[model samples]
Target: MTDHATTFRRLHQEGLLLLANAWDAGSARLIESVGAKAIATTSAGLAWSNGYADGDTLPVERLYAAVESIARAIRVPLTVDAESGYSDDPAAVGATIARLGALGAVGINLEDGDGTPEALCAKLDAIKRACAQAGVDLFVNVRTDIYLRGLAPEGERVGATLARARLYRDAGADGLFVPGITQRTDIADVVAGTSLPVNVLAYPGLPAAAELAQLGVRRLSAGSGLSQTLFARAAELARGFFRDGDSAPLSAGAMPYPEINALFAQR
Candidate 1:
């Protein structure tokens, strides 16, 4: 049996694991071309990238299909963003993650969000037990959204995050993810507080890869930021082509036709 979780954990330990979130095969191949070590699915990016709303609007079948496409496209370990597991029941969600393992997935981003902390921890525990029972080394990327939800008042973001992180870690989470954190001091503080490797969202000019590496950041997820940037650029290019008729800046004699042709291949 392939040790998918084992393979993924090594990536976290060795260096900065830049997980390029790909909603389809083309993005996976493109990230592979640029030498990304692993590929991850973005729940928001996948839905929005494919013209659906965020959250469970995409459905489990469609999201699972996206993961299959990406897993087939790249050899690197794949981590899926199974948003809230799309269900309230933890056992059912754990079943979903285990099913993903059957499809060659090594890791998953599970969030303890959308409810109270105690409720979220129970869900996390359920998934961990399921992973262990399956004999799969599942790298559970636990996302703590205290800051993301604007609940970290009194500059207590670090303390709040630590509380969540400690709970998840003790509950058997593989990593702690805290997005929307903007301060370097807080970044260091959070990293200091948790024995688990910290994962932060990418921000402009906040910290370089080296700076984050020094702070003991094991993983750096682009979250939905990459998809947002891509769409923004695409919107700009669309306007140019609409008015200029094939004289757009994006059509600057690049994007090989063969690579584009390869996107729609049957699986």
Candidate 2:
């Protein structure tokens, strides 16, 4: 666990760490097989895969089970997205993170969503304490939704994000994630404003990987984009099968069965 935790932390020190986020054990293993340095879960994808909606709606126990399964499936470091930590109480959130650590997650993405910075800080503090007591090491990536949720007025979003970044950094964050800021100037400003590794989500207007690295961005995540696309594709295939009973479209562009089976067969 210590080794995995250290490796996960070191991946953020330089360059842009591209995370093709996964939602389940199969997705995680496939990602690792494709040379991903680390695996980060997409909360929305994971929730939807388990028949639940995104946000803080999934049961904590289900979250734990999912993390454990992914951890066991992949050899690389695993980071789970605990959306709002699944509770408002800092202690409960902290305990939830600690349990994830015990299940082999080396890092976590904890978002502030519509909550206050002070609330996130309290949760970070509690997480630090809980992990220490439980002898677990975790990289707490603090996510501020200032840009994602339009928490600030135009032109002042950068300042608001930096302010929250400072608070989260002081409260023991290892990285700062600003999910919805896409402009080159805004991205550069946020990176320059904070010392923590800056993570940006994959969006339509976001810069390419090389440009992001040049701007000092440390990590880029796919979020739920891949899953959403897969959902759409599945729906299309199902519709075709139901309408014309054509089996050809279902196998088109599909991964070979043996190749996918080999992934799980290794374990």
Best of the candidates, TM-score: 2
14-62: candidate 2 lDDT, tens digit per residue:
6889999999998999999989999999999999999999999999999
lDDT of each: 0.79, 0.95
Q: Runs in model 2 with CA error above 4 Å?
A: none
| Candidate 1 per-residue lDDT over residues 1-267, each given as its tens digit | 265567788888886787767767777777776787888878888898677898767777777787777788777788888877778888888888887776778888887665777776777778877877986667888888887787779488789999988888888888888887767899999989988888888766558878888888888887777788888988988987898877648767668787766654553
Error of 1 at 42 (Å): 1.5
Error of 2 at 242 (Å): 0.2
lDDT of 1 at 144: 81
Per-residue lDDT value at 251 in model 1: 64
Q: How high is each candidate's TM-score?
A: 0.91, 0.99
Q: Candidate 2: what lDDT? A: 0.95
> What is candidate 1's CA lDDT for residue 188?
91
